[model samples]
Target: MSSTATAAPAKKRGSGLFQGLQKVGRSLQLPIAVLPAAGILLRLGQPDVFGPKGLGWDKVASVFATAGGAVFDNLPMLFCIGVAIGFAKKADGSTALAALVGFLVYSNVLKAFPVTDAVVNTTANKGVDVAATYNNPGVLGGIIMGLLAAVLWQKYHRTKLVDWLGFFNGRRLVPIIMAFVGTVMGVFFGLIWEPIGEGISNFGEWMTGLGAAGAGLFGLINRALIPVGMHQFVNTVSWFQLGDFKDATGAVVHGDLNRFFAGDPTAGQFMSGFFPIMMFGLPAAAIAIAHAARPERRKAVMGMMVSLALTSFVTGVTEPIEFSFMFIAPVLYAIHAVLTALSMAITWALGVHAGFTFSAGFIDYALNWNLATKPWLIIPIGLVFAAIYYTLFRFAITKFNLTTPGREPEEEIEDITKA
Candidate 1:
């Protein structure tokens, strides 16, 4: 075969892999969509918000807090089901059911193992034996099980079986296969996950130890990961496992978001910087895109860009605007990533600590104000970043003739929504 033919196949394979990753990334949005409501309810239930002096409804606050906490507590299962349904060929009920079965079996099997903190220290004097929950894999495990369930369902949902097994040959086979596979996975993880888990835990600690520099690196990597959808994995570590705090009830909480909500003064280091990027920087970039459009196309571009800008400002959902220019102007994306790193470092140095349940949007910034340290600083910082983003983006777009929104030729114009 000609080298050109071989190159074509390689290109197709690369495209297929990229598409697969994008699918996984998109799948994560399903579960993440629930966090904002949970965060709102949880915050509303806080003493500073709706408790004693405010609504004077302590019991109601407790109920709201518990209701919201339930979602965070069950994130692993949610991710499992969400990913399964998202990746399944049909997004049907059966795929979700299979994912649940797989996760339950995998988790319970790990629980069955009598693992201790140390191999030789089983006595209470050295270290007490751990509970079944010790084997819990958190959301990462859920994502794995979900992907497995999706794959199994996609491949075996319509497989034929022997005559006696005909009744279970179709959709029913999925859960059955998952149960067996889950058992195997449970045993496999039980044997191997200790070191893996420790490595992740240690990495999280190292990142925390790095302070401002670490936060800066995380910001840069987080933005770069957006295109491939792997940002959520890093987010899981940063938001769910980077720190530890004990709540009023003495229960331990982990991750920046959880610890912040649980009243840890030291939390939110990983989250504070995004406020400027999402709420101001990206919106300004949208403005630059709008300003660079062809004169005749500016009106239509503004209508679309305005919505994207407002979405970023209010909700901190920057994908609409980021995606608009990222592919067409990758250099701009790179610049955005570097600016994010700078923002993280600057925010950390300024002692501006803020937390969010959903994202670094206005809603979260305002909602968590009472719990934040120097929360007012975010506004000034955001404005400065906004100016920087607008100046840089406008200059870059003009110089490069980048195809952002309305700059494309009439025949080649594509929908921003689709991007």
Candidate 2:
């Protein structure tokens, strides 16, 4: 008559973390994927390419330019959509709409008064302007607004209000609250715009001033931060968060080093360094993976590798490929990190000035080329990097017996599946 001990119920895995990660991945997918196509269009529309009597392909070029230009120009809208869906509990339409409301409020409030005009009229010569708040509704800003809307929706979506406002309570209340909240944020942004912008610009200059070594550091850190999704924070500090430098007349000017590279293209310096790594290095790495695979698996691996490589090279969507080998061959991953650092250093040394709205892919290269000071050099530089990547990866795989692709044991694969 001994009492049998009941085994504790198997602990259920938290679906929240997984679901959240999926949403973020999904949110980023479309925007990141679309960048390369945009880059190509931008390249086609360059004055040299599409100008009058320049090329017979003007019509074809125009189409690419229009499509890419649309995405590049409306980054804020894209961010809003991405953030809303990424943060929503159910990925519903209401969340997306709420995000739009937040964006609209922030935009309108910021636009109502131009900062420069206000500064001129004010007694304080150094006072910040209001227009700066609306100037660049970047990815970070979109995320913030989206999160605000999501939180509001989650908290009040089911709450009942007084009879007079009952109809407007719950789901309908989200947009209303979102707009009001955005307006409040607009006021705060307007007040601090100048100081925030200046601080960010100074930081960008400091990083840029470090030259090749700085680029290497940036590359290593960027990759390290990818797994947790906090790379966005670094992005904001380097790109969108920084304020634009200005000339003596107070007109916005490019930072010295950045101007020397891409001129006044997009927003940041760190983004430019990625062009070499993404367009050339990653694809080469993919080739090495295919080459290292067993003969029987080569065709299948090649197909997958080609698709993933194309996406990385063309658009800068690298997660699928990076994740492939990251878990299986961490030593190889470390090598990849070092190689990435070297690529950034090399690009900096060459004075190549390509930048990207997305990843360092061909599409971004194409889009940003015209805007870049020496866009033609990007391809040549990237090609060189590609060669280096191939040699290094191939050698490392064979010499070290790195478990890259075909090296994984059947039992290990089975265990991974079971887990």
Candidate 3:
């Protein structure tokens, strides 16, 4: 074939794949978006709606629970399918089939060996073994498998083979190769998985031991890391780095210490600290900015302030609020950080266990509250944080003439965008 003709096919395939991936990404968005809201609703609305003798409540609750459960349960499957299709050259049904093949191999390998049993034998302990084999197949693993399968499919989907294996060559060969790859991956994971998991668990326990100081540090680091994508890595350490809890029967139970604080028994030591900062403290800071604004720019500043406060309080998206003053007045940002630490300390001291999956906004608060132990205490603590935020912010802005919002000198206003 001529060079142009050969390249044309490749170019066409690449373009087609890109379009397909976009469609797949869009399709996945709806399902992914629903996950958080469904989680919140099921958690918050469950008791009231499913309580004894409630009106049509049981059915409504059951439906939401079932739908949400399916999505939560099948996240790995979704990632495999979504990513395979997303990365494939043709974005065909075959790509999805290859993904399934890879997923099955990866999942089964993790499930095959009981890590807890191995540990038990090594320790010779009659005591309960807290470690389990494997937790749920995560998004990272699924995406890796998907990409591997897509590559295999693209590479060998049309290759010929020897007589006996000839039938398996081409598209049919992708899955067979994936199975072998999965086996190799399984062996690799088996070797290092235990030590890695333990190391992570120890790290988390250490962080938890840091108590209020740790919480403050986490908040500060979390904020700083958001501009980059490293936050997800940090989150993994905080969230799923631990192995499953093992029961007396040697069966691995599906729960982690992190979840204990944020999932059930909801008074997670680390998570509760964010409630005050997100729900109350940030809003108070916004108000202070408004108060500090130049009289002429008060209306403009007020508009920005209101938007920031609402987003912070209702949705827990602090970037808009933080960015508003972060660059212009870094001292104020430092104060915000200090106040966050203080809030964490106060909440920790007061024994509040509030946790949120999204931001520390009211929506997540409402969703997680019902599932949390002593959920009602969050309100009182948050109110206190609000008072603290308002007082400190007002004092600092006035005392320093910090160029917050409207208080920026006219010359500085032109440079605000640059900052």
lDDT of 2 by residue, 261-379 (tens): 22353333465567777877888889998899877668888999999899998878888888887877776678778878877777666666566655667766665555665667667
Q: What order do candidates take by lDDT, descending? A: 1, 2, 3
TM-score of each: 0.87, 0.74, 0.68
Q: Which portions of model 3 miss their true places by more than 4 Å?
A: 1-34, 44-48, 51-60, 75-101, 116-181, 242-263, 398-402, 407-419
By TM-score, the best candidate is 1
- Alpha carbon deviation, residue 52, candidate 2 (Å): 4.8
lDDT of candidates 1 onward, in order: 0.86, 0.67, 0.66
- Backbone clash count for every predicted candidate, in the order shown: 0, 6, 5
C-alpha positional error of residue 59 in candidate 3 after TM-score superposition, expressed in Å: 5.2
Per residue, candidate 3 scores C-alpha lDDT tens digits across 333-392 of: 787777777776767766666666555788888866555666677778878888888888
Ten-residue stretch with the least lDDT total in model 3: 253-262
- How big is the positional error of residue 63 in model 2, measured in Å on the Cα after superposition? 11
- True-vs-predicted CA distance for residue 249, candidate 3, Å: 14
Question: Between 2 and 3, whose lDDT is larger?
Answer: 2
Better of 1 and 2 by TM-score: 1
